[model samples]
Target: MSETNKDDRAALLAEAAGPATELPPGWLEVVSMDMDAQGVARKSDGKVVFIDGALPTEWVSANTHRKKNNWEAASLMAIHRESAQRVRPGCPHFGLHSGACGGCKMQHLHVGAQVAVKQRVLEDNLWHLGKVKAETILRPIEGPAWGYRYRARLSVRYVPKKGEVLVGFHERKSRYIADMQTCKILPPHVDAMLMPLRALIGGLQARDTCPQIELACGDTVTALVLRHLEPLSEGDLARLRAFAAEHGVQWWLQPKGPDTVHLLDADGAEQLAYGLPDFGITMPFKPTDFTQVNSHINRVLVTRALRLLDAGKAERVIDWFCGLGNFTLPIATQAREVLGIEGSEALVARSRENYEKNQAQRPVQQALAATSFVARNLFEMTPEMLVADGVADKWLVDPPREGAFALSKALADLHQARLGAEGAPPLPAGAAHWVPPQRIVYVSCNPATLARDAGLLVHQAGYRCVAAGVVNMFPHTAHVESMAVFERA
Candidate 1:
């Protein structure tokens, strides 16, 4: 080879490799963790780098996968100094590798540290977004670390090229299904069914039609809702029945939307219900209804919320965004009158039925307090509507990820009106008689939204953020479920 030819080869190699400085030089110190469980570090140029599979206080190098002017997203390449809070991930399918499961993000971090990180996230969100701080930081509520997921939505895909069916969560940041044979977060029995489920679906005539399976486990019964686009044949139905019998699971089929969900065989199936033993309350729900994924944490959460709300026998309480009367009925056991409000009429109707069902089982001495269910779009609340609903002594607010913005805003409006603040909205017709609830216990799923609503309550509504804390509802995942207590000043 000539000298000129060698020089050309060297140039070609350099071009193929792109930039020699693709990876960040030296070790980066992870100072904190973002909401998604990614480690936050600063590069030499002062740009932020979000590194996956890295923990706080750890020195590491990362391989950049995405880059921008202000930040770079990278994966942990090497750990020069590992943090004591790091631990081996429990799940075989959890990793930064290709086709890893997206179900969990904090499996590598110690479970105790995971809860601490979530608490910091809540605190950061409150201070940064709401510009409010809680007077007291409540103790973090923790529960069973593993086998706690009582509900899951497993995606099903038939791969003709592989001649197999995949049943699991999506791959990390990809729509492709993860090749998961077992899951650590799921109940052992449910986890054991993964391989069998794949085999069952792969063998079915309607394998190509079935797209998803939603699992919901009650105290006495486990239900699986199968979503199928095409009609199943008699053979496929029999197979489902046989599988249900073998696994002691109930099968619910959904031909289209959630409304179309029905039991495959209702004659001998156990009623799906979870019991709040402390309150002696049993909640019966359909497979499609919105129920907590972690039953244990939910029961504890309800108990803690009621304890914090402290609705007395003489006081009237309202449960906002109440679905299935989870809190209203329990509150009715103590309060003079309790109202359960929800946006969906169907949910309100079901909540009424649940109230009736619970009443039938109660003894004469243990009778429930007066309770009523009403359908209302809480997101469109106004001060006038608040006055019309009458005054409640206490409230239990458990909104979804959107949080209770309008309700908070309504209270803020009423406060400003009473103060005669400039530019405040006009008071409603019955504003004089409308006394705001003395206390509110808010259950939130999103910290950012919670902080926004908290701002309205603390700064504008003349309420003190008494206490707040994190609820480890979904362990191993980056989800942050929390609760906050506010009291009128």
Candidate 2:
């Protein structure tokens, strides 16, 4: 854990789980990286082993821990030959214990090496999960390495004996909060405010009452949503308001779950807003609204996506999983028309609101004439629903961790049927002449889903993954964020 009593950490761990495992003689060679960023190897007894805190291209001796029939897991014991890419981590707290802040992984690897590993992870997943190969590999998109996180949810816990309250991310491999003074991933301002936040929390009698603080920073506002397990007392309310005023921060309160998140001082004229200045669109959202944390890379990504898609005046486009119109509103400024589809009705309404807000101030003659949004159950989507939504000339999909498997499959069926000469074409008049969107841009948060959906798009849908690349949205951790471009055959 990040916070250690230092008296008996090893002893406590031993008491809890008794010396996880023993290291076998003869060092095993690490062949590859598994789903959890662990190095994979095997022992002579046919037991596969995974070593935590180990990377690819490096051979390390490890202590075996968890075991299964096909695979056994291990922790790094000794490095026989370390990769040249290994570098000192930027954050001091980045290791098994003192450095263990469950927030980031792969920090020990060089930044360039990190990107390369992410690309490899994406390629491996696509080939293994989807059995599809990209015709071209686009250069990985990159951005600032530090102070990029604009969305965060910090865990709050109090320790009366120490007369302190810890506020930061969770501990490595555990639910406890990491005792950290600052976070490198957060925006510069938020990172600077960490210790002050801890102090604020420590001062409150309701220190234990408040369990979380969700953060979202926009161009105009930095909203803090406090998640409290119990109701805040008048004293706690005053303390929070004082903290907010002192820090120039907007405060929100959640007495219970997410549904209870509300502005604590709304009349103070606070609105959280993120913007795509290139598209001349500013997106206003509640702190709870789902948006990518890395704004610098998001800008790069959207620009790259539009360039690859080549959305233009002659074509209309659809933005699937268009949460809060992040990509939809931007795409609208380039394409002739745009249809944004989302999973939540509230988000759909927000998208429409954002569209109108941007349209009124649209630059250069309102590049796109009209744009709209609809809420649909994308995972359970059917061909009929695809037809109902109106198939556009091109597609831009930015799904959640769950990729667009159902929608891609449904589109494939409709496209094939339309070409089969006996089935009805999807959407619009002169259905027979309707051709499926010629190109599709898929933005994915999870490589597995991307690979699975790519399989359906390539093998089942008569499309080929023309180009795919990785984007390190969350730089520290093993989580891989990627994008792929598919073209119809």
Candidate 3:
């Protein structure tokens, strides 16, 4: 090794082995990191310490703020040694300081390093929680590090004390909104509107009643949804119209739940939509619908997911928890038939509408395969329901944070029944001809729940984890989005 490299390594070792009396009282060497982006260390007695704003391989002094029997939560006080991956955060509102925005966590770490940590977290969750290891680790999917957030819900509060409206994310661990003027994570156009939005909200009579502003950006249009507890006066409505006209953005108002969201001026307002050009499909959705926050990554994700699924032209495919037919329609373009199932009838209807819209747009010579949508409470799935749905050649399971626990468990129960295990549920009548999908591609936003369902699939359902990898859907954040492919053994 070079003399300079040797000296640096020796310095780090010396710092780590320094006497307890020489360093700060709570000095500890961060050994690893957790899913929440906290640095993990242990006291001499083996008591675990979770320190915020610290990274693995860094030695920092921490102040314990919350303690339990087994672990203590602390904040970084001083760093005696720094990690090479540490970087200056681009956003002024991002930090551990008081009143900082809670929109992101890993901004201080290098973007590549952030993705690596998330990849490690996915691997650890799969092995430690599910005890299932993938046969191959796919390359991580990456996109732009900034200006990638096509969706965001900004909190608005009229802080009477400051005599101004506060608009942005909530303060870290605080209900009060952060005092941010601009955000780097949002699309550049949306980021430019942050201050203007505050001014616009501040000028309204319902400013105090208005609680949130949600942004959804498409290829050519940006839609903002304002959540107001009370009705807007005529003057306020006029002001909103003027602002929308001036900003080149459409305005949607929500007086109640997501179902009540509608455009302020529907006439001549462009429809909100995103396109997956790979499949020549454009999906129209309301701002309140559960669309992926990162549109660019979502497109790449869909492409990768469909590639991994490898549905044959003559094969049938099933999309569980399909919202707006994002995957179902794409699969329909390639497969013989596609069945989309979701819990909400409203979403199912929308999915069907999207399927028809795409079909109408397609050339007469190039028609999509048969596609259908159904609403069923996936959380209450059973072997009987599985038999009724019939078997598909492949499954695309993209569930919410809760994951497809019930669906996975049902499959496991069916396998047990096939084995004639004691106390196992008897096969539903006419299920003697039932068969499970040959392959399943699971897209997950929560790694823990994915691990749990993966355990059920691998250990109980007679399937093997073929390949898995992390998707950098939300960069500079602790959120780990992943996809795994499972094949029947």
The better candidate by lDDT, 1 or 3, is 1
Model 1 worst lDDT run, 10 consecutive residues:
13-22
lDDT of 3 by residue, 1-489 (tens): 233433333333334443323345668888767777888777765566778999988989999997765567799999999999999999999999989999999998999999889988898778767999999999999999999999998999999889899999998878889999999999998899899888999999999999999999988889999999999999999999998888899999999999899999888888899999999999999888889999989999999999999998999999999988989989998899999999999899999889888899899877999999999999999888998998799999999999999999999999999999889988898789989999999999988789899999999999999999999999998999999999999
Instruction: State the lDDT of candidate 2 residue by residue for 154-214, as single tens digits.
Output: 9888977767898988878888788898788888889989999999988877788888898
Encode model 1's per-residue lDDT on 331-364: one tens digit a residue: 9888899988999999999999999999999998
What's the TM-score of every candidate structure?
A: 0.94, 0.90, 0.94
Task: After the best TM-score superposition of candidate 2, give how far the Cα of residue 314 lies from its true spot, in angstroms.
Answer: 2.0
**Where does candidate 3 stray beyond 4 Å?**
1-25
* Steric clash pairs (candidate 1): none
